[model samples]
Target: MHRTLLWLLATAALAGSAGPPARTAMPAPPPAVGEAARTGGRPWPVPGTPVVVRTWNPPATPYGPGHRGVDLAAPPGTEIRAVAAGRVTFAGPVAGTGVLTITLDGSGSPPLRTTYEPVRALVRVGERVAAGQLVATVETEEAAPAHCKEEGCLHWGLKRGEVYLNPLALVRGGHARLLPVWGV
Candidate 1:
């Protein structure tokens, strides 16, 4: 008796159904906060709009192979500027190449550090630098090995402790946002 009643209910439910449920459109979420939003508008380290020879390519694992920074095409002796106000944490050579690092002010815990390599240091460690201030000049080929084979390039990097971030985000105010496909 219970089996017969169950069968009747199942038959009635299926008979009332037309087909599978239709999918409804949902609103796209807002863009995530980026470095530019957190640090305000930071300027590009290189003068003018330098051509990007290489973009940031993060590693899959901590020890994985990846380009930790972006490479901007600049000629030898091109002036380099500070992207944000901060103190110079390191200004010296690393493996025969001149390197300069600045710890950004008010960038939160651990703070954000910006680094430029193959640059002759103009600011010393512990020196407070303001945004857009000249910090260093790109090293000549004779001073250091060429980073880019075709032309001299400045390797710019940004990190919060051990995590590497896209440096371009600092200049652009954030990453590019994609629009919804349905025009929402």
Candidate 2:
């Protein structure tokens, strides 16, 4: 019965076509480069924040699937920052994702890597940036703008070479323990 119900839901979603039932409308996007973005931002998303965290690695099915990234919920225009120092490997609108992917040369667990564009990439594939630097902004689409299995939340995946690492481990490693940000 459960399997049948799941199949039915999947069928309905596909039938909608206008793109996954049109997720709740997020507020119109704020200017892409807000103060933080302009200044390589910091703790941007906070509690009460509306979006949902997508993936934290693997980017597949977390359990029986491969989890490739970490996800955070937010509206478009939310300032995104580089966790550590690195070079921008690729940035631009790939497919439909307004996305940005930064490959930290040396920092934050095997090159502090960060991606901000699942909807539209901002930086190029090889732009050098500093830690806390603003790489790009979020998209303000009613549904997941791009690069997502489902357009609902920000999917973040941390990786080193071919290994998909858990994002929380990095933040909670060694001595520091930054609590997960719920929403603002």
Candidate 3:
């Protein structure tokens, strides 16, 4: 009877000593990209509102032929600014053309990356740039192949992972909203 009593006490003590059950820690989700856009208003990369020489034309397939980005008509030597705050991931020449890419901060997993080409980079790679901050200047005709032929243009691109997205959507306040219709 004493042994049974002692075993019961020991079991009770062990159970009482043990604290609440352990919980597995879950990683916090990343901030939404739209929230970042709201905090950082959409700003034109070029001075004023430059004409869009070519609009974004997404391809049917990843390897399909299509314009991956938009071409903004800006003369050579024209200053180019960042459309959003991000860290410069690439700032150098690619395919004989000066290219600059910025990976947006707090834009979720595999963050959105913005690309600008045919521009002489004023900011180097790994640099943190604010929205509307000057990052480069339009590359001269002699420096690289003009995307818009004789007239120079800055090709702006946005990508999340390998999928290309419309950069103008950023400028146009992202997704379109629907209006309520009244019954007549």
Residue 31, model 3: lDDT of: 33
Cα lDDT tens digits, model 3, 68-137, are 8777877889898888889999999887889999998876566778999889999988999988788999
Winner on TM-score (1 vs 3): 3
Provide the overall lDDT of each model, using Cα atoms, as 2-decimal numbers.
0.71, 0.48, 0.71
lDDT of 1 by residue, 1-184 (tens): 4433443344333323223322222122112223323555556787665676766776779999877777887778889888889999999999888999999987766677999988999999999998878899999876543447457878899887898776755665333333468855
**How would you encode candidate 2's per-residue C-alpha lDDT over 44-109 as one tens digit per residue?**
222233243443323334354544555666555556656556787877665666666778564433
TM-score for each of the candidates: 0.70, 0.54, 0.71
* Residue 163 local lDDT, model 2: 53
In model 3, the worst 10-residue window by lDDT is 21-30
**Order by TM-score, highest first:** 3, 1, 2
